[model samples]
Target: MASDSEVIARGDWYPAHSSRSAAAALVPRTGELIAIGADGVALSVSVVSALSFSSRVGAIPRRIIFADGSVFETADNDAIDHYLRSSGHKSVSCAYRLEKLHPRILVFALLVILLGVGIYRYALPALVELAVLVTPPIVPELISSGALSTLDKTALAPTRLSEHRQKIIVERFERVASGAEGESYKLNFRVGGLIGPNAFALPDGNIVITDELVALAGGDDEMLAAVLAHEVGHVEGKHSLRQIYRAAGVAGLVMLIAGDVGSGVEDVLTQGGGLLALSYSRAAESEADRRSVDLMRNAGMDPVALVRFFDALEEKLADHSRTSMLSTHPGTPDRKDAILKYRAGSD
Candidate 1:
């Protein structure tokens, strides 16, 4: 109020010579700030280059900071704001801008949310695909070993199929796997228990077919052979490895978002994510089915056996809704039609 060219903020400041804080006033000059003690003792002079302002947060006091680490604390926010406006001193801090335009913060938050979704849905998968391309062979072997051991202890048990049955099935599947993924691939049998009739390919070219699936085949070697070839197709295309990386990406994304999801929702997400990984997407399933067809044709086996297998599964597991037209794996109907079209050269 002394003059239009000057504004002063009455505050408390700690002078270098003082043992404690004392009454002080910040006086703005042509292009600098000067601090004076209550008795009119000159305390500090801060040039524009060495001067900074703290963010205006609510009704909290603001600080006029200087290069020498000294700060002028003041509760006179209006005076300081007037001084900054009159002196053409624009605060460049994000906190200040955001507070000044608080409504825009919501818009900014929405943009950030959209960007995160884009990264998770689109960019993450592309990144995982690239990562899978560079993954070392040993990594898959270690992962497969650990996964098999864990399953053996939990959902899967030792196969109950007779040695004769096991031998015949293994030999037949060996023929189906002959022209794909080389000799490193092997087949194993397990009692699916509650997992139902299913087959899965490990990253390291090992395929495990549940005993329930073998029983589901009803002793038809062509159907069993087709199923094994489909799993080998998974091995040949490195689909399992892709699934492993995708699942990891999903887990990371979910963890990034799940700050407070309770056990129930988190459990639902976990189970859904597991099913997603195991299903390997409709595209991947289709690719494996095609691969299955190719491998079966190469081995002089019937390709229609896969379609028949689907029909049988749809009938047997009708109560489970697993093979429904809405579930993962393109639904049994879509897959059957696709397979038929592929075989007939109309796909």
Candidate 2:
């Protein structure tokens, strides 16, 4: 028999064998669990029997069952667990050692966090690249179709440019786009609606150029072709799809790290998505600018035309108190400087 003073757990007990009798004994007598022989367990009531711990999901206190139709429970589950383990009895409790500040658990969690960061920074981008490489030619077409349809319903108006002028621009754009393959390049002309003087690429090969943008270029076919070539760079690089995926991945990773707090995480991720997209679009624009300069040089058009066009666009936006394409694509002066440098190098 273990000493009563050697209390491993302190809680209420029910000595009744039947549920009715147990209910009748509404008052619970204080009880303690103490170690006996190597594998034996005894309650404070002097009833020694095989003991086991069981718990229900979301239940706070743990229950200790005795073979002699008695029960014990305590809120101090850690004390109970420690007593059982120390007494050489098997303990089955859903308790994480991490809760007790176990070093190994903390290290494991740290490793998981580091691994997640590495995958997010490096592996994810590589995976996106691989995915884009294997994507079918028709996928972009379908994406463009759906996206253009949506824009048409909400943000775009039919092109007001004369058919003859539209045809001339289309021919020029085609010549600029000639070397690009696997994407069925289709030119779209739309009135800018809320987005003035913009040209953007869908995940598919459709490039939408605003009529405002065309008029902004002041009928400089070379400037228009440069913009078309830039959009082509986006399609070739799968920038739009990659941007969307990266934002979603980041949102998921943040939520995973945060655990289940509430729906606020979802709302934050959703609202921040557009901001992330804009940032990624800036990088995409830089890449497209590089490609545009190359295409302009190859097509025998002066690459300086693109730099001049960006300057004009920037001035126009400033005069109107409107956000330029620079709001998304960004880097007007730096991009212009880089283009001039590239032109100088190519000379």
Candidate 3:
């Protein structure tokens, strides 16, 4: 027979005997709970220590369970907290306590965010590189085959360049390819259309160059060789495949968490070819640039042609069109400086 003042929380009680429920109250200080039917005090229990409480989370209803397999649910989370703190029924979980805006909790939250950033920035690429090493040879061939078909269906058009022009470029490019060690590469030409002046590689040692890029090179064999050699470097290092794996790993993680995911991994590989050209990291781009310079020097071509091509490109592409390789590559001036310094050191 506790007074209203003694009731710390009010809720609906559902007895194990029936699905029906009635108004209930949690009376603190004396460790008692009461169910009030129309007749009042239909049941009373003195088992607060034996009761289990659901963890408190913002505004979500909390539950209390009794020894008789009955449940009491209430929205008055603060009253339950006060009862626990005052009576010391049992320690509430740290997660529930952290919901309060404490300085220490905010600091912990900040540290967690920083750790996530650190893992994405540093750990992800290292992990992706390791994955690339263990991946089977057939995997790259499969990804490359799918990606080429996807590109043909989406961004690329058949090459309109004549057999004579293609023959000459192919002959000249062979000299450049000869310097690339271990894996050999075959050069392919495309019309590019909206892709503008660009060159990129597939995972299977296939280097694709566009007619627009040939036109941009203005038939300077050294400049064309530089671009082709740069793409060869990407293939040699498996840079494109590494990036695709990195992105796919992230997509796979999101799918595992989101529960509604379906066929996204297949889509990323077979339908996402358009993204492959622009997904290169700046560090990867720089490494390819160095390899380009090294190969050009080895092939009896001037590495300075690459530096001059950058200068000429900056002059020609004053607008930096929204959908061009210039938009994704590292800053031209800094890259040019690095190339000059590198060439000087190599010489």
Candidate 4:
């Protein structure tokens, strides 16, 4: 290492260049000189004025040697210390402090959160609404295509009853409902092998009367008409349709959470079919009862036949579980009350 006097004389003391690339080149001030090695060649350059450090570069102290005899030191010479101080050159610390934050990441995160919320709240509800509309209409088609086919092949085709009796029943129903409201609906009746003395109306206007139900009427035309009218009332009100839609809406929510609906749709449809086969609402049952009264009155039959038929039905069904019929049709007590009320009133 060169002595302090030699270092001062040679002006090899203060930083000759900024450590940072961004910092500007600095020259010594007047009455001072800076000795620097450039490309391995030593050179001394005299300064005419105080050297100014570039804001882009770091600060560098000056080294001076007086002509009288002593070396002048503006500041201590330490390269590591100077580099550390110059690190703040170009106002790096201040620039970093003032730097603006990128909002893109925050905005993106907010958008993802909002999208998730929309799918959960709004999108799911809309999907349920769509399923409601689609399910009702589809259920009837599925039942007609499957259940009716199964019954026709297995039960009705092999029945011992005369075909003429079946024809007569069909004709009577058609004649009575021919002029009724919603008469244009394609109405058909079939004999289902379902146990118990019961009958039911399907969503597609198909009414299934069990053999037990037929036998219970004792072949009385008026009694059969009353039963058919009540079932027809259920068809007209689309009670089965509403129930199907309700079940589908619930199934759709389950499928959505389970991921792929395509694989589960058949299972959902099967389960929904079982639910559809069960019962109608109390409000729906009442509406059907009222409709039956109207149909019987219009068909020139004593609407009181419905009351008598119900009395007979209540007796036969007493020991059986009334769950299925009661679910879709009103209780016997309610039906009896409705009949009495209708009988007392005029058209």
**TM-score per candidate, chains pooled:** 0.64, 0.61, 0.66, 0.53
Which pairs of residues collide in model 2?
140-204
Tens digit of per-residue lDDT, candidate 4, span 236-283: 776665655555554565555555556343533444235335566677
lDDT (Cα) of model 1: 0.74
Q: What is the C-alpha RMSD of each candidate to the true structure, in Å?
A: 12.9, 11.8, 11.0, 21.7
- lDDT to native, each model: 0.74, 0.68, 0.77, 0.56
Better of 2 and 3 by TM-score: 3
Candidate 1 lDDT by residue in tens digits, 145-193: 7777767877788999899999999888888887786438888999977
Give the number of the best model, judged by TM-score. 3
Instruction: Estimate candidate 2's alpha-carbon lDDT, on a 0 to 1 scale.
Output: 0.68
lDDT of 4 at 154: 55
Rank candidates, lDDT, best first: 3, 1, 2, 4
Clash count of each predicted structure: 0, 1, 0, 6
* Model 1, C-alpha of 2: deviation from truth (Å): 42
After superposition, candidate 3 runs with Cα above 4 Å error: 1-115, 255-264, 272-278
How well does model 4 score by local distance difference test? 0.56
Candidate 4, 263: how far from true, in Å? 8.6
TM-score of 1: 0.64
What digit string (tens of lDDT, one per residue) describes model 3 on residues 185-262?
A: 898898787777888788888878899889988878688888888888888888878878777776765554455557
Clashing pairs in 1: none
Better by lDDT, candidate 4 or 3 = 3
Candidate 3 yields a Cα-based lDDT of 0.77
